[model samples]
Target: MSSTIAPRVRTLLLLFLAVTGALLAGAAPVSAHAALTASDPRQGAVVDEAPAQVSLTFSEGVAVSDGAVRVLDPKGKRVDTGAPADQGANTYAVKLHAGLPDGTFTVTYQVVSADSHPVSGAFTFSIGAPSTTSVALSDQTAGGGVVGGLYGFARYVSYGGFILLVGGATFVLACWPRGAGARSVQRLVVSGWLALTGATLAMLLLRGSYTGSGRVGDIFDLALLSQVLQTKTGAALVSRLLLLAAAALFVAVLFGAYDRRVRADGTGEQNATGTGDTSAPGAGSTDGGTGTAAGTDSTAGTDSTNSTDSTESQEKSDLAFGLAIGGFVVAAGLAATWAMAEHASTGLQAGIAMPVDVLHLLAVAVWLGGLSTLLVALFRAPSLDAPVVRRFSRLAFGSVAVLVATGIYQSWRQLGSWSAFTETTYGQLLLVKIGLVVVLVGIAWMSRRWTARLVQAPERRAAEAVRTPVGAASARTRKGAKPKAGSGGGDGKRAAQLARQRAAVASAAEKRLRDADPLRTGLRRSVLAEAGVAVVLLAVTTALTSTEPGRTEQEARAATAAAVTPQTGALSLDIPFDTGGRDGKGVARVELDPARVGGNEMHVYVDRPNGKAFDVPEIKVAFTLEAKDIGPLPVVPDHIATGHWTADGVQIPMAGSWTIAVTVRTSDIDQVTVDKNAQIG
Candidate 1:
């Protein structure tokens, strides 16, 4: 059995790894929750003059750090005059220095989202005309680089540990009380506790680096760690550690005190039965003269038996009640840590979303974790009672119901529209998870049916026992029946022999049920399959937490609007040229009045290296829309001034990136052609 089961478990694990790898490889780059939707001056726009301040808008609220918004000039030097200020409505503005140079500038920002994830990005906007810039673009973003990968892995570990810890304990307390004494169950629950504790500590140590610098070395930085502890995420992780300490005590009681109590209770019951059996014959064999004394002894024995039973019953009730309460508090507390610091705390209807998220997490842990515990018990326990499997079935069914209710609410809150289901990464991943869960549910249903059959086996056997012929009983009595020494019809000894015969038959029936039960075997296979799919589902869920929600993506798109629009005034572009000849280098200033999808006026000026007007032998200009493959629309401009040319009715057919090719000839043999891209809108 171990050989067969080992191969199956290995296969399932391999499949899980392959599927997770594929999903991660195909998944879009992980980004922070809050998205930069729009910015003042517009990205890559060339304005006639610089604005007083640079403003930015995001899809959600954010907290700005000191120097969070930095504006750099063409020389890569900071140009922003003051710190960033909040302008409400999820907008922030940073004042720029007065009289800024006429060149491209880079704006880099780093802010914390409301949900405590860091968001960072950079954009470029020109003052008068786009020119060479030395400002390097920032590549830092939330959940990117080596630190992010480690943090993400830690998150997965934490979730896995949470399931094992909660599910194992709940199984021992609610599904199978006797399992507490079993070594397998004891190890399962204890390992869960250890995993959760270690993962929590790892998260705390990595949080500072994850949110600040993407450097692995920064994880040990005392300053960063101090700052992290002051934040909400830090507080939550600390709270989890404290709760885990409490959980450790609970585990000790469960496997130590609780296991001993269950074992002692079983032993005491057996001893009580043996004592009653031995006392019964003595009371019956007494003479009539001592009838009163025998009656008193029997009464005393009856009272003692009742007293022991009552005490045992009360102890069992008290222990069960205490475990239930302790388990719930610890599980709920651990779940709350995630709810208060993740996507649920920032989105729409967050007040209601947080609690719903907690319930959703709890339900997932119970069902998936419980399935693992049941699988181990079924395979290892010598004689697992059918009642334990039945109890877990009911538990799983209830958990699924809760999952459905809370899942729908969460989906609606995050998506906000049906189209998002197919259009966004978060929604697409959600669909995949839903599909896996459906398969898991089907497998669970099959397992439930098998459990029902297993539970009915005892009843069927009892019915068969009742239907046995009277001749069979007579045969058994004739084969091994012997009257005891006491001669009064030998009724007591014969009754004892019949009781022993019944016990032997029951033991044989139980043995047959354990060794030859097809239902148990079927249930184990179904549960194993369920667990395999559930592992994949959990991976998808972890990915979803890092993905940007569909509603936020949609809102960001709407806020940014079109990338280009018709210019209200003449747009100017400075294009530099060198013909590789003596005194051939010059700058061309091209102007398009009202650059849009229609006819527009244009002007071109050629200036020498010393900023003086210079005359060229010949000049030519044409426009091409490379995206649409429309090309080489020639513009014949007549020379109106030295180093100047003008044209009218230069038609632009559409809105897109258009290449303006310029040809200049300083001499017959010295000529060059240069192309510049311009947005025609």
Candidate 2:
């Protein structure tokens, strides 16, 4: 019972690994960052009056889909026109109703990036002045809650199913032990196929809902499903279902129908043997009277057994060859569908990228699928095959190597900089995946060592052969000891009894040999532990797929750094003064616009320390290019208000340092000039 149960557990594990590997293989490509770079009325800016329109600019080109952008007033009611228009290249704008009240408003947007990933964000701006009655908009989009989780889980299920369905069958036909086809093993393969099929269909509906309303109830929404069916993602899933159907035919021929044929032939051969045994005595007794009849009967039985064996072998070989060819083509098609719809196909050199991704996915499936099947075989079979284990070890090593190579290319493509490893969320997740993979490899090393030990100890099989249940041993002993009382006389019966005693002694010796081996027990434990860790590694891989790639985040940051990043904008300062005169202490404010080689405005305002306006007799402002031969350009300001004065058309001629001096003459005898340095870029 323990032996029977062990294989089932391992079979289930293999199925699990297959599903996980497949889902991870189809991970969506990470999208570049599409940050909001600029907006009309600017984020958090207070305008003197409400504008007729609101506009937003992103770091990258954005596609407007349903609910792409919304404008909400301070009352949280939407006010922008229903449709948004694209302005220039990356800007989207929507008109506001006439005469919008003076208050804060929020702009919320969700746009699809060039890589087909959604980027969402929101910001707030006010009219007249900053408002206290407005609600704070979130800096980032909200998560997709329970519906999103289900979608992810469904993806995991689909991937695992594909791996198990294809990889498991391939392993059994190509590398499994010749003596290792238990009912449980067959069931495991069938279960995987069914799981993949069901998961594929489930994903179709879930995808529609996820992309549309992102609500759990939308899973059954037909309108969304129809819309989704028109998308690339939907088409790929549909193709997967069709390929799975074709694969089912291959599985039926290879593992199901062929297996039944083989079993039927075996049963026929067994029946022939039983018939020959029952008629043997009668033939011997009548041999003298009918020698020809007995001879013909014996020859016919031999001929029948030989014929059955040869026919069954030939039929199995032919069917297996066909299954292999058909299965490979079908499996490749299934893998292609996933590759075409994922991130890899959308990126650079997609023609080559698609095949590489497919190969990477297939290799991963093979390794994980084989490991799962191998673990089951080890437990179910009495003795492990040295050659089989060695072959699987080599195969696993090759798969890991391929995974590493492909993974490197993918990493380089996504994370264009080393800084992304620690800076981006996607990069951090990748680092975690790498760590887990390393640990899994270490465990695999231990498993390889056990395989080596098993190879060296070929005598282990001889001992395990007799480690059958005690009841079976006792029954065999009884059957061997018993003799026919009325037939063949005492001499024949005595000879048989002596032979039985010898056989019993041999069984006891074999049992003792089995009991002497402790390494066999330890090896089983190690393999099981290794399998546990491999499962965890697969789980981490799934997580990696869901996360955004570091490369995209870095690209987005670079783009934002390019746009909306001013070369040189405005600079201002407020210099305080005291002239040792009554009511003379005041603040002088100085401003420089576009501190560059262009005409700029310089405004000066004077205020008393107690917040009242300070009236000065004269105000003068001047600028001198520092460390250069340029002299000070003085500007006599025209008073615009009681405390405010401005001098327009002030010029900064070159890109260099400059000094601005503001002089406030309250009285002719009490005058002070405040100097400040500025850089023109």
Candidate 3:
């Protein structure tokens, strides 16, 4: 039977892994959650001239790493002068090299958001004209692949381990004290510990690669490991590892000391050696012993009973109290490792959210983990106590209440708005988890009903036994029996036969109680169903951590206002020219009001190097769309002031990168034409 069941269990485990893989595959990519709301040079804007520095603004605060911001010239060479500096208000700026040449320049950045998620992206802006860039643009906006999958898998395993360890231990201590001596219970809790420890180590090793370049080789890099240890996430993992060491001691005490105590207290049928007593009651004494010997034995037995009743009772109470305090500390510490580093640590009302989240995690571990423990006990224990099931039912109900209350607060804090429920991935996953919880609750309700019936069975049986006559029970047992001829001492022989008949009847009744109890069977089935739904719910919860919170996404969208359209604003350009003539190095400030695909007015103010008005022999302006091979459409401007030129009805026929050429003929012999790029929208 074991061999046949082993294969079926393996197959089901494989199927579960396949389903988990598919769900994880559908999760949002492990990209940084922070959004880039705005930037200096404005993404694709054509600056009149290169600025000394470039700034990026995010929806949340971000930490800059070495070379977090890089500026690349059109030739794909680095032009950034220094590292990025945090300018506050979720803005960071990096200096650029002086005298950056005319062409489009790319700005790439990679930073860690306040929430410990890595953010990376790139943008471009033109200097003089929109020229074709030779810069090789590699996609670095998101980081995730093999390393990410492994990290994610490790996370799921850690959660599973937490549930098993916390739940199994709690079940043994709080629900079924006798289970402390059960091999199945011991193995379940130990497996949880091992799995959680291993998964934590895996996460530690994979963190660098998962967030960096998504390389497998980086997992072993000591340098990367050092870097990881310095971050919040790293600190949390290390703390968890330390707590696990303490948990190891706790597990030892639970299975070793606690189990022995429970068995010694006679809570479990088996002794400390896991063997039942086979000797008949009072068989060790000899009937031929003297009265004094018999009296001595009676006195010793009474003293032993008193010693056990006093000393053992106090010891049990002390041990249970210490275990309770130790377990709470270790469990809360483990939960803190998550709440301190994940979304709960950085979002709004984080001070309140962190403790609430820790409670939420603990409640899940207790309810889901306890359900798993109960299901295993129901199937494997020789004689599962009805009281144990009742205890767990009460515990589960409390856990569910805590889950509901904490879940509502967390949902509101993470989502913020109603529309986000449908618009955001985090909210959708949350909705799925809630639905699973509801289904699980319904299953638990059914299990509770069965538990109630199971608990009442013994009472009902005892009542029936009291109402039935002993003579009737004996007559029923003796039905179809034959009376043998009496030998010497026939009365004694008859008494022995009656005793044997009663023992057989009691044994049969116990068997019937076990095999014929439909309520116990139904409870097991319902608990199993609850555990199954819980596993899926856990998967969804894991996915939610990877996905961006809806509140952050909404905030990002809110920060990123609508772009300025031509109808609402105007385009201005400062074209610099050096005619290589006397007093010819100056700037021409040109403005196109409502620079759209229609007729517009143009104004140009030519200033000398000292910012004073300047008169030129001739000033000519025209626009050309180089991508479309369009000719220079002339915009004839008449000199309206000493240094100002105005042109009415300057029609920009289409929207594109239109090169505006300005010719300032300081003299007939010395003139220069400068081209400035403008995005006409």
Q: What is the TM-score (0 to 1) of candidate 3?
A: 0.73
Stretches off by above 4 angstroms in model 1 are 1-28, 81-83, 138-141, 278-299, 459-515, 562-681
What is the per-residue lDDT of model 1 for residues 1-681, given as tens digits with 9 covering 90 to 100?
545655564455344434544555323246577777667777888899889999887767887866889999999999997778997657799998898989999998887787777888889999888999887775656557877766666666777778878988888898998898887677777777777788778878888877766789998888888877888888989999999999999999888888877877887787677676555555555456776787688778777877887788679879889989988998999999999988888867778989999999999889988887887787667368889999999999999999999999988887878999999988998999899889889999999999988888655653455335333664575465534465675687668787677766755555555656677778888988888788888889777877788877665554344323445677788889999999899998888888765568999999998999989988888999643346688887889999999899987654556899888899989999888998766
Tell me the lDDT of model 3 at 552: 77
For model 2, the local distance difference test gives: 0.69
Q: Estimate each model's TM-score.
A: 0.72, 0.66, 0.73
Which residue window of length 10 is worst by lDDT in model 2?
24-33
- Scanning candidate 3 in windows of ten residues, the lowest lDDT window is 272-281
Model 2 per-residue lDDT tens digits across residues 255-282: 6677766676666676677576646555
Name the regions of candidate 2 deviating beyond 4 angstroms.
Answer: 1-42, 45-63, 82-102, 112-118, 126-143, 177-180, 261-311, 381-384, 460-522, 561-565, 569-681
Ranking by lDDT: 1, 3, 2
lDDT of 1: 0.79
**Pairs with backbone N, CA or C atoms under 3 Å apart (clashes), candidate 2:** 18-160, 19-159, 19-160, 19-161, 20-160, 22-159, 23-159, 414-551
lDDT for model 3, on a 0 to 1 scale? 0.78
How many clashes (backbone atoms < 3 Å, residues ≥3 apart in a chain or on different chains) does model 1 have?
1
Cα lDDT for residue 211, model 1?
Answer: 72
Q: Which is the leading candidate under lDDT?
A: 1
Error of 3 at 248 (Å): 0.7
